[model samples]
Target: MENIKFIDQNLEKGLYLVSTPIGNLADITIRALNILKKSDIILCEDKRVSKKLLDYYDIKVQLFSYHKFNEKESVEKILEIFKKNKIVSLISDAGTPLISDPGKILINEIEKNNIKIISIPGPSAVTAAFSLAGYSDDYYFYGFLPKKLGERKKVYEQFSNLESSIIIFLPARDLVSIIKEMKEFLGDRQITIAKEITKIHENIIKGNLDNILDKIKTVVLKGEVTIVLSSEANKNKDQNIDINKEILDLSKKMKTADLAKYLAKKFKFSKKEIYQKILIFNKK
Candidate 1:
């Protein structure tokens, strides 16, 4: 499907997993807009919240509240409509459905009933943050942080070891605490915190846990935050290198200690290891 092109054709009369903008109003794709506009009935997290977007675009389709708390009932209500052969569209307050949201139940129900699910993808904060992070793209998506510290630590450790970039959705109130905990669990890990995505005051703060704390010290951090962290091993920095080449260059006129220091600075390693390598190379 082309970007910014509206879907003008007839869609199957079941469920449409429509993606909305994570941040930046313009991020919404034409396909998503087309689906939202053409849907017979729209299921949203909040009627008022979704209405703002719908009304802004002059969408007058039927809107209803369908969220985790009311999902069981909503499912039955939705099924009633589906039986009538009406096409239903599901959207979250922001971003794609089922990412820290409860739009998946309807999708599962539709699948179980042997109905089809049409997907019209749109912008995601996870994607937005990663693109601007200036970090490696290989990553995983964790919808949200665990409520308990132990559980969160377990999750954090796993990501830290893999050294893969991670995207986490966090409540505004818990943002500072979560960042602080991340600092303790993982040392010197880089993070990019994006807040109020797409809307004004959209901020992407990039730094280590401690550095970010300092940055947000005087500022009032409102709105939800999507935390994007660099992998445990940052590839942009000189962590991985050819030790053979390192030794070859060190053997030429530089003392082991000096060479080790130089290599250590370039590649995030201790000087002692490089120094020993130099001695071993010098002996040969």
Candidate 2:
């Protein structure tokens, strides 16, 4: 065992974005423990969830709830603490703060006020999933697919044709439906599903979209999930396709928004870009 030094006085007056473990409590760094132990107040998404981690490590710091609903109300009150040169730390219920989590608004205010902000980085699901997936040299990450059907379609469409692997964080419950939908848009592309990463029952499942869908039906999946999608191998290569002609043909049958969204997902271009092109073609 190694002796770890816990720094308290060096914890300067500012906002500390501490990264907590996604599943395993031992994944947390010694520095993060020090900051959490010494900070005047720890702003967390949920006090109940955060308490489990705090109690696990014997950290008795003051905890406060600052989730999305109360975030607008808490900004100024937190800034006032910063003005008094008090050390404040912000953490999500799991993983790092502001990664598909609240704290962006608070961070903006902190920077605007010119108060210092420190990052005590540690475990994150994105990197964890990517490392385990081993699909590509590079990848695109979409944290939590959109809830609305149209928006979700657009998200799947946007990444459908990407050469790089797509990493996403989604609920385990929606796994079956999401895969069925992805199969429609993305075909039987290979994917790796990392469930409850770093925890005791952590399971990583890998197969094409079709097979994994069947496999998941055998068991009930609980807790959070991270998915990594391998790039399409042979079909829908963008370079050989005619964007203008596809747009022209689809425009005849589809609404402008729908066509833009459809083609946006089919090609590498964005919806806004495709929409503008369709508008220009309409002018002719």
Candidate 3:
């Protein structure tokens, strides 16, 4: 156990967005532990969830509920604490804050008051998944994919053309369906699915979309899954594409959404961005 004397007693009166362990309790850093122990107040996404982490360390501080629903109300209270030069630490239920979690709005409000913000970074799902997903020179973090089938397909379509790895957080319940759609839109692209990372039942599966689909057909996933799709799209992408000519030819024959999906897969451009272009072309 690390001593509390290591913690800086002079921590400024501001918000500290601290990163907690995603699954394993031991993954918490010494510095992070010290901050949690030393902070005057801890603002957690959920008190029950955060209590587990705090109980494990036997370090208790003033905890307040400041999640998405009541963040607006919490801000004024947080500011009052700051005025008294109290150290405030913000932590998510798990992993880092503001990554598919609340804290963006709170941070913006904190900055308005010229409060000092510190980052006590530790464990994160993105970096953890990437580490297990093998080597990829470039990667894009899409956070969470759209829940609706139509919107999700468009998202898969837009990113399918990228020559860089794509990372996404998806519910385990929707894993099979999402993988099926990926196979349809992204072809047999290689992917890595890391689930329950750092936990006892940690599973990391890596294969093409078809391979994953077949393997997951029988098994039921229990936890949220983080996916990493390796890039193998095109070595010579958009080099032969004449944007205007292709738009002119396809625009007349295809619907706007269809055209956007087709062009996104073909040119490696964003489906949503291409759809915006299609709208302008129709007006013209």
lDDT tens readout by residue for model 1, 159-255: 6556578888888788889877776555556788887767777777888765788887765666678888877567334434476577786578776
Please give the RMSD to the true structure for each candidate, in Å: 7.1, 6.1, 5.9
Ranking by lDDT: 2, 3, 1
- Weakest lDDT window of 10 consecutive positions for candidate 2: 232-241
Winner by TM-score: 2
The C-alpha TM-scores of every prediction are 0.79, 0.80, 0.79
The TM-score measured for candidate 3 stands at: 0.79
Alpha carbon lDDT of each predicted model: 0.76, 0.84, 0.81
Candidate 3, 158-259: lDDT as tens digits: 785576888999989988878877766665567889989999888888877757777666556876999998775522244324655688788989888898
Candidate 3 at residue 199, lDDT? 92
What is the Å distance of residue 110 in model 3 from its true position? 1.1
Which is superior by TM-score, 2 or 3? 2
Best by lDDT: 2
What's the CA error at residue 113 for candidate 1, in Å?
Answer: 0.6
